[model samples]
Each structure stands twice: as structure tokens, then as C-alpha cells.
Target: MSKDPDLELVKRFKEEGSLESFRALYERYKDKVFSTAFAICGNYAEAADVSQETFFLIYRKIKRFSFKSRFSTWVYRLTVNVAVEKRRSRKEFLALSEIGEEVFEHTGDTPLETLERTERDALLNRSLRHLSPKLRTVIVLRYFQGLSYEEISSILGISMGTVKSRLFRAHRELSPLLQRPPFSAPPGGQEDAWQGN
Candidate 1:
């Protein structure tokens, strides 16, 4: 039977210790790995670190992989694990909206829209913090990182049904926080907004 191309590359790397085989894998998946890390980290430096270490770990550990799952799935799991570990080791884990706007800026938007988007992203990031790490991971992978259910299931080492349920619960938890009207401060010298006039 013909081997999967990625598996073939892995085989060549294992048998021949070929730099080219490994490089082929790196070139194919680096962007995906980097993007996944960046979305979780919300910072370029940390993401770069995660990407570098993830690939390094893959190089060191790929031999033990049993081929039970897709190679991409294994890569995603490794990348996410390394990124979360990096964030956990820090006293201040970088939050989502803490990211620079310039890094994510897109074309064809008015200044007003940009400001609104930035604010909304900040608010979403804040709300995300209130969730448990598991739920937060699901939300980030599903919504923020745009991964599909099957992909997320593999990445998180969970069943697809579990991924869906986690996302459901996450959205439920976030709904109250996200669905509320935009916050407005009381006028100067006025009573708190919660107080009846």
C-alpha cells in the first residue's frame, strides 16, 4: 500500500536521517503550526518560541508517534501543548486582545469600524478569561482559530462529540457576557447606572 506523503517523509527521515525529508515536513506545516500557536498566545514572540520548540520537540519525539492519528493532528496537539505550557509558566499569560492591532489589521475598513472591532475583540478577550481553561481552549480553537470540529477533536485528544459539547457549554457561558448591551458609564455626578433614578 502506498504510504501517505507526510508519513513517507517521516519514514525517510527516520530511515535515512535526511534533512531534506524533515525540511519538507517543516515547510509544509510551519505556517499552520505558527498560526495555531499565535492565535493561542496572542503575541508574536511567544508564538515564535512555541513554533520553534514545537518543531524541535517533534524532531526529537516523532519516532515514538504510533501513527494512530493524522500527522497534522499530532502536530497540532504538540503545538498547542507547548504554547499553553509557555503561557502557564508565566505569571501573566497574555490575553487575546492584549495583542497589537497592527498585527491583525485587515484592509477595507473605516477607522470607526476598526476602533469598534478592536473594542469588541478586547471585550471578548476579557470574557474569555472568566471561562475554565478547557472551555477557553475549545472556544479559541473553534472560533478564534477557525478549526473544525474534527480538527479540534484530534488536537485536544477528545472525541468529536466532546468537542461539540464543550463548545456548546462555552457558548452558553459566554452568551450572557457577550449578549449584554454595550457598557455605558454614568454621566458625571450621576448615580451608578444600576441605581434607579
Candidate 2:
């Protein structure tokens, strides 16, 4: 028996053509797919479109999903590929400013603190917007998705060294922009600290 928690569901969907299994998978990954799409495409509407299309493609291709990689990794790769293609075809891209609302939530704070936090969030969003897609992808996968370097390399189909280099570049670019103490990696288990949810 495969140790992958989702393997049984995937097998049911792939072999028995079970819609229930597929729906289960969809429920599990919808938010992740949408977030990755939004992070890459940088537009809510476009991300929604990408998410829908990604699921459609997954439904069609699940039969071909080899067990060589984790199902989640394969899904992320599909999402990233779709988002990148969509981005490349478009003439302009928007900054994912909505990310600030989703990521940073300061409740029960003084008005002054709230304002300062908002400004900081805005600065971070703008800084992220300035990074190239390649660099931004590394940042999103590492910090936003809380993926490991090995997982990122697998998802992006890049070498571990390449993933590290891109992350280094992204951090360097964002640091000056987020000045006031400069941007740094979040502590372990706090990967979602930026994400107030």
C-alpha cells in the first residue's frame, strides 16, 4: 500500500473513474491551486480562470498521473505551468495586492499600528510585484506555499542549486524594498505567519 494519504482516492479516480474521488481531490486542493495561480498570475480573475482550467485538465489527465511523484507535487506543477503559460500570453500583469489582505491580518490593534502594518503590507506587495516571474516563483513556493527546497526543485523541475539561487536573488531584491529592518525568511512552522488565516 502506498503511504501517500491521497493514493487510494487517486487510484479510485484514475482506475474506477469515480467522480466522488475526484471531487474529494478537488476539495483538498482548490485553495492551494487558486493561491498558486494568484501568486503567479497576480490577478484574481485570471487566477480564478486558471484554477478552473487546472481542475478541468486534472480531471482529463488524472489517468496518466504516474506514481513517480507525490500527487500534490504533480498538481502544483500543473498549476504553475498553466499560470506561467497564461501570464506569458498576456500583455500585462497586475500586482497581487490582494495578497496583503489574505496574508497580513492585524486584529485588535491600535489605529496607528493598523496603518503602519497596512503600509508595510503594501510595501511588501509592491516589492514582490517587482520581481521577475522566475524569482517571484521561488519566493512564492518557498515562503508563501511553505515548500522545501527539494519540493520546489521538483515542482519547478529545476536543480536544487538553481532553486537556491533564485530564492537568494528574490530575497536580495525584496530586502531593500522592505527596508525598516529588511526582509528575512520567516521562522520554521511560521511559514503561514504572513497568512493571517
In angstroms, give how far residue 16 of model 1 lies from its true place.
3.2
How do the residues 1-197 of candidate 2 rate in per-residue lDDT, one tens digit apiece? 24778899999999999999999999999988988888888777888999999999999999899988889889989999999999999777766566545546678999999887887766666678778999998888888789889889999999999999998899888786677432443436454433432
Quote the positional error of residue 168 for candidate 2 in Å.
0.7
User: What would you estimate as the lDDT of candidate 1?
Assistant: 0.77
Q: Report the lDDT tens digits of candidate 1 across residue range 57-133.
A: 98999778887777877888998899889888887766554556445676799999877887776567656765777
Report backbone clashes per prediction. 0, 0
| lDDT score for residue 180 of model 1 | 50
Query: Quick one: best TM-score, which candidate?
Result: 2
Instruction: Note the residue pairs that clash in candidate 1.
Output: none
Against the hidden reference, what TM-scores do the models get? 0.73, 0.82
The per-residue C-alpha lDDT of model 1 at residue 197 equals 33
Per-residue error (Å), model 1, residue 65: 2.8
